[model samples]
Structures are given as C-alpha cells and as structure tokens.
Target: MHDPATHHKPRIAISACLTGHSVRYNGGHKASDLCRTQLEEHFEWTPVCPEVAIGLGVPRDPIRLVGNPDHPEVVGTRNPGMDLTGPLRTYGEQMANELDDICGYIFMQKSPSCGLERVKVYQDNGHPAFHSGRGAYAQAFCERRPDLPVEEEGRLHDPVLRENFISRVYAYADWQRVLAEGLNRGALVNFHSRYKYLLMANNPQAYRTLGRMLGTLSKDDDPLVVGPQYFSELMQALRRCASRGTHSNVLQHLSGYFKDALTPSDKSELQELIGQYQQGVVPLVVPLTLLKHHLRNHPDPYLQQQAYLQPHPESLGLRNAV
Candidate 1:
C-alpha cells in the first residue's frame, strides 16, 4: 500500500471524464484502464471539467467553436446562442493560478472544450472550416505554464508517447520532491546512485551522461556559478535521449538481468529471439516475454527491489509499438 503521508505525492490534473465521471460534452465518461491503474497507484488527482466548471451544467447542449480562432465564441447548437467565452476563459485562468503544484495534466480526446489538439473550428454559418484547434482551457493552461508535461488520452495510445509520459511524469515528480526536501550532497549522491541501473535500462547514453555530470559536483564544485542553470541543463540533455534509444538500451540491459542463471535451452531460446529482433523479423517484446517468463524461475531479490522493472507493461512495444 502506498502511504501518501510518508511518500512524496505528485499532484496531477486529470480530466474528470477519464475517472469514469460523466463530464463529457454529451454527459458521458470515457474512462481509461491504464489511466485508472496510474490513478490508483500514484498521483493525487485534481479533476476538472472546464465546460462544467465554467457554469455549463451537466446534460447541457454541447457547444462548438465558431468564427476566427483568435476570437472564437462558444455557441450551443440547440440554442444557437450560448456565449461562454468570458466565463470559460476566466475559470481557466483561475484554475491555472490556484493549481500551482500541478506537475502534469492528462486531458480527454478531441473535445472542443478540453481536447489538446485537432479540434474542429467552425465557420460563421456553422460549417466545419478547419480541424486544427485546441481546447479553450487547454490553450489557457499551456499558455500559463509552458514548462509542464501535458498529454491527451488519445495520444497516450502510442507506446513511445506512453513511455515518455511515464518517464517525464516521474522525473517531474521526483524533482519536486527534491525541491521540497532540499537535497544535500549526500542525498543527491545516493539519489543518483539509486537511478543508475534504471537509467541504464531506460537510456544508457543519458545514464553515462548523468554519471559524467555528477563528477562535477565534487566538494570543490562551484554551484554559485552553475547553480542557477544546473538542473535545467541536466534535464535538457536527458530530453535528447530518445524513446528508441531507451528501449534498445533496456533490451540489452535486461539481457544482463538473466545472464548467469539461464539454462542451456533457455539461453538458446533467448539467443534466437534476440537474433530475430536484430534481423528485423521479430519484435523486441519476444525477448522481453522470454525474460519475464524466465524471471518467474530465477527471482532476484535485488531486481524485485527496484521500482523501475516492477509492474512491467506487456502492452508497450519499442519502435514498432510507437
């Protein structure tokens, strides 16, 4: 069980409909299974339905954007007149300000009021003019805080995006914890140490880069000159390490997780699977499946102790899944 009081919690903003609440444009919900898993395991959610929050009642007629996007108005189809621009924009600003600690956001799909991208923008005569517009609240939210990681539920279907989301969310969450607790040199060293293996599995280039970076933080290291830009520089480098890079690194690293214990037959099978992946005949998951199955027999206490490999998702694929 996760003890919220003892552990550092990430305050995440999620669309209310994704939590199985009926806050959709048509008074329905589109809860996601993976999202629910994350909700239960991690995250302290601050649910918001912008349209509902801005005084648009549940079961109300749906609204769509019309005219110039720079000055679009929300008009209800049934009424032909429900201007919610002022209230919606105002509420968005309020939420953005009040929810200062929200490290990330998960939005619903393709909604004019909540979708993060590609929403329909209608013309003055209610004809569809364009299919590239963002939600009112989402635009406002991003405008207010451009640094935060934001993802729409539809996009999370991609494995690479999902991996990136998970990694970035955890990184942001951990950084906030470090900020709150005030990391000392000793703690920072240990923190970096704990992530060493995980970094290797996720992204070796980044892992090696981080190791090299840490070497500069010695006792004689001058943070006064670099302190202002240290963390930003570190993360920016990490951001360059692609999902493909990490997935490839992870496959190679997991090979070490079972290097010593596999039987001759198992070794041959693993070898064959890897050969297939290398030859572009098989997906990376083939070898990973064998590893996960092999893990059942030769359980490493230390491997299980690590949080990164725990609860491994079979659903995710590397470049193929992406």
Candidate 2:
C-alpha cells in the first residue's frame, strides 16, 4: 500500500473524462473545472477510464444498464447483445486492489460504468425500469473499499457536500498515516481526540459512542481488533452532513474555551455571530474566522489541536458557502 500520510499530496482516483480526457463514448469529455484546476493543485490525481481500460475504444457505442437494478448488466444502448458488465466489474475489482493507497475518488455522474448512484436501468421493452442502479465498475470498486471517501464530480458543486467530502479525504489520509506508523491504543486515542469537535459537529452521538468505545479499551485490548471497527463507525458518522443547528452547537462549545480570555463585550459579539449562523444570516466562515482569531491570542493547547479549526485548506474557501 502507498501510505498517503507520508506523501505530500494525498492521492485521489478520478474518472478520466472528468479530467478533460476524450474517453467518453462520444469521443468528448465531461471536464470538471474544479477537478482540472482547483483540486488538482492540492492533490495527486490518478485518472481511470474503466471503459477505455476494458478495451473499449473512444467513440465506442454508448452503454446502458439493464435487468435488475441491484445487479444490472452493462450492455450497448443500440444493440443490447454487446454486454460489457463482466469486463467492467473485473476491471473495477483489479483497480481497487491496485489503488488501495488513494485517499478518495471522484466519479463521473450518470455514467453507466461510473455513476455513483441513481443510474437508470431499463426494462426488456426499452423503457426505463428504475433509477436505482449503480454503475457496474463503480459498484464493484465501492464494495471493495467502502471506507474510502467517494463523490460524483457533480455533487462537489454543492458547497456542503464538497466540504464534507474533502474533510473526509483528509481525515482518511490521517488515518492511513496512523496505520503506517503502526496502530496502537495510544495512537487511536490521540486520533479520536484530535477529531473530537469535528465528530461532534457532524454526529454528536457518534462522538460519545466512539469515546466510550475507546474509553473501554484496556492495555490488554488489541488495536488491530478495534481499529477497523472504530474507523468504519467514524466514516459512517461523517457521511451525515452537519446541519446549521449542529454547527451552532459546536461553535458555542468552542466559544466556551475563550470564556475567561474574552471580556463581556467580546463574548457577546461571538455569541451574536453564532446565533446569526444558526439563523442563516451568515455563512459558517464568518464565526469560524473570529473563533480562530481568538484562539490565536488566547492559545489553549487543546483548542489548537482540534482539526475542526482547519478541516481543509483555507484556500479552498469551502466554509464561505455553508
């Protein structure tokens, strides 16, 4: 495994077409400017065109999913006899193993072989049966690495989803570093501590649940046994995007650390900003920027270690929207 924590740029696997490669069936690209420019600056990209990798040439016949949505078959749209489901599935599995080190993946939306969700599966009569199918290769790849962060390029346009996806990718990279350094009870505990506020904002129940789970660990207990379980739960918790209410709660908690350092007037200002954030009067960045400034002056050791303060690069400006 390529240990992403040791690498300067966290590795990301992306759909080739999204990167402006002429890999689509029509010999054109879906090119996402965000992926091609913005994200490309911070992360290393590994483009994969499963269709092309499966020996399907550019400008090849378009394919569609058919039969049971849960186990759809990828077949040519014009001629159903041309099936590529088996090859695509095999290739996905192979790549999953090869790209085990990648911190995340960005799939092309609505693709019969890359769409992450809601792909249309047609009936035998050429009518759309349901829109619940997953792309053949995507389904296989996701099953192989359910813990990995993944999002369709289209979904990244939504600020909240984009922020969540990027945060999870960085967190996943951090976890990979822990694994590379060797997992132990101490390392696991420290990792959870660093993400305390982050987990609370996203899923408060998970924060408590995971805390108790770790608190129960004895020196005799094995991290190898608990590491996978803990990570699975943590990732699942992150999938639920934090609401404004949750964010307000977390902001208030962070504000408490500055209670003594802040005078009555400064405290009142901070509270008003948090209240405004809850009421949707301002974006999260406004209050967060203030909180960070206070932390810089007051400088609490624990507060400084919290990943919530800087979940992703400030240059991304993800918090400005939500």
Candidate 3:
C-alpha cells in the first residue's frame, strides 16, 4: 500500500529482535532488512524487548508458559520458576498506552517471550505442546489494543497473511485518523470506504461485513454506540481478520475489481507482470506496482478513494523505491 507520493505514513511497534537488535535472550539479532530496506523509509518504529525489560539476562536460560493456556504465564524454568508475569504485564500496558501512533506489531517467530504464534507450550509434566497459546507480553499487548494489527514474522511470509497484516495496519491507521478528528458514523463510513476494495481483494466476508456496518449509517444517529459495545466489538473483529489468506485467493479476488478499470492493452501488460509474479520470476510487488500506477488515473472516483489498497506512498515503496 505504498502511497508515499501522497505523503501518508504510519508508525508501528516491532520487536527488537526483528530489527536486528541484540536484545534477545541469546544475545544475537534476527533483523529483518525487509523492514530496514523497504518500510524504514515510511514508518517510525518503536522497538521493545519484554524479556530483557523484565530483568532476564542475555544468554540466560529461556522461558516458557506453565499454566492454563488462557491464564498461563511466563517464567524461567531453570531459575526455579522466576515469574516475569508482573513486569511483562505492566510494561505491555505502558507500551500500549505510550504508543500514540502505533498501528501494528511485527514480532519475532517462535520466541517464548515474543513469538505471536507457534510458541512451545510446556505441560505440567514439563512436556512441550509444540504449538503456541500466546506470549505473556504479546497477549497483554493485544488485549490493550485489540484494534491494532499484530503478526509474527514467520506468518508474514505467507502472502495472504502478509496482505492481511498490511490491511489491518492501514485500517488501524485509518481508525486513528478518524478518532483524531471525532468519532462518527460518517467517519466510520469513510474509513470503511477507503478499505472497501482492499477487503474485496482479500476477504469477501470481511468486505460484506463492512458493507453491512456501512448500511447501519443514519444521519441523525450517533455513529458510536456506548457499552454492551456492539459497534466496538465490530471494529475489533474487523481488525482481527484483516490479515488472513494465501495471496492467490486474495489476488484473484482483487483482480476482479480492477479488470474493467484497465483497458485491454493495460490488462495485457498487467497480466504479463502478474504471470511473472505467479511463477515467482518477479516478486509480488511487481504487479502491484503497475496496478498502482494505473490506479492513479482510474476514472472511477470510488476505486481511487479506496485508500486501503494504496494506504500510504511508502506501502509499495513507490515514492521511496526510486
């Protein structure tokens, strides 16, 4: 969703491990230059390491979950059950609050302290579950900002998952923009409108849900509903599903909308690029690059207004890539 030409950008929180920070328990870094080279030009990143912040020393014995999956907490098993519950929970709370502009989180994979998915859960008998429940710190972070996009680095390698992550990040940023102005159904509609095509691209169900929400609009009504929170939960659910897919399904879905927007010649040219991407001869961004270029001159104001596809100029590295 790079739209750097429009001067739109977002701020995000990412684990230090993903940024190549030596904040891991192993004293090594797993920096993602995908972020360093591509996204660095657009987003301002806030780095965090819950394990280190809780007084865990570098190269220390690793930690794991040790209770009910829902309520299980983190601890250093070899250190006679040193609990990191309090500090991690508190820090997550503060991090959530302090992150004024944060729209998403990119965490390290399989980290007992930071992994968002597939973390090894230990049983009472001290056996591994070989799956993730969630990390204590990451769980708290999600709890605090359920509307924010959260993805583990490993899952992001999946194109569908990656698209979903990107969609949610931009959508959350859109929500932030709406909140900054004032909460209204009009703002909500506007927010959904921008993301309409993007959702249609990834998840048809999500697109329809949003369409129904938009249908609820009433001129004299207050767009925001107070507690019992129907509207509130709706927003949360949308953000949660923003990332989920295989690129093939999503790309096929999205291409439908763009078919008529392109001329026969334009479609042919774009198809060639897409063929290259599908065959892995070119990266996924190549077709998106062309689609974005043509979208600028698209006759349909409605399509152009779907800002979610091209959320910010830097989304596709359009402005900064050159």
For 1-322, candidate 2 gives per-residue lDDT tens digits of 1122344778999999988999999999999999877788889899999999999988999999999999999999888899999999999999999997899999999899999998999999989985579999999999999999999999999999999999899999889989999999889998898888899999999999999999999888899999989999999899889999999999999999998899999999999999999999999999999998998889888888788888877777889999
For each candidate, what TM-score against the reference? 0.66, 0.96, 0.76
53-139, model 3: which lDDT tens digit per residue? 877778778777876666667888787468887788788887888886787889888776676766777877888764557787887
Q: Could you tell me how far off, in angstroms, the CA of residue 2 lies in candidate 3 after the best superposition?
A: 9.8
Best by lDDT: 2
Global Cα lDDT for candidate 3: 0.67
Model 1 lDDT at residue 133: 76
Candidate 2, residue 263: CA error in Å? 0.4
Each candidate's number of clashing pairs is: 0, 0, 11
lDDT of 1 by residue, 100-161 (tens): 88778889877777778777878967677755677777777777766567789888776666
Query: What is the Å distance of residue 16 in model 1 from its true position?
Result: 0.9
Where is model 1 more than 4 Å wrong at Cα?
1-11, 37-43, 68-73, 78-81, 100-103, 184-246, 249-322
Ranking by lDDT: 2, 3, 1
Cα-based RMSD of candidate 3:
4.8
As for lDDT, the candidate ahead, 1 or 3, is 3
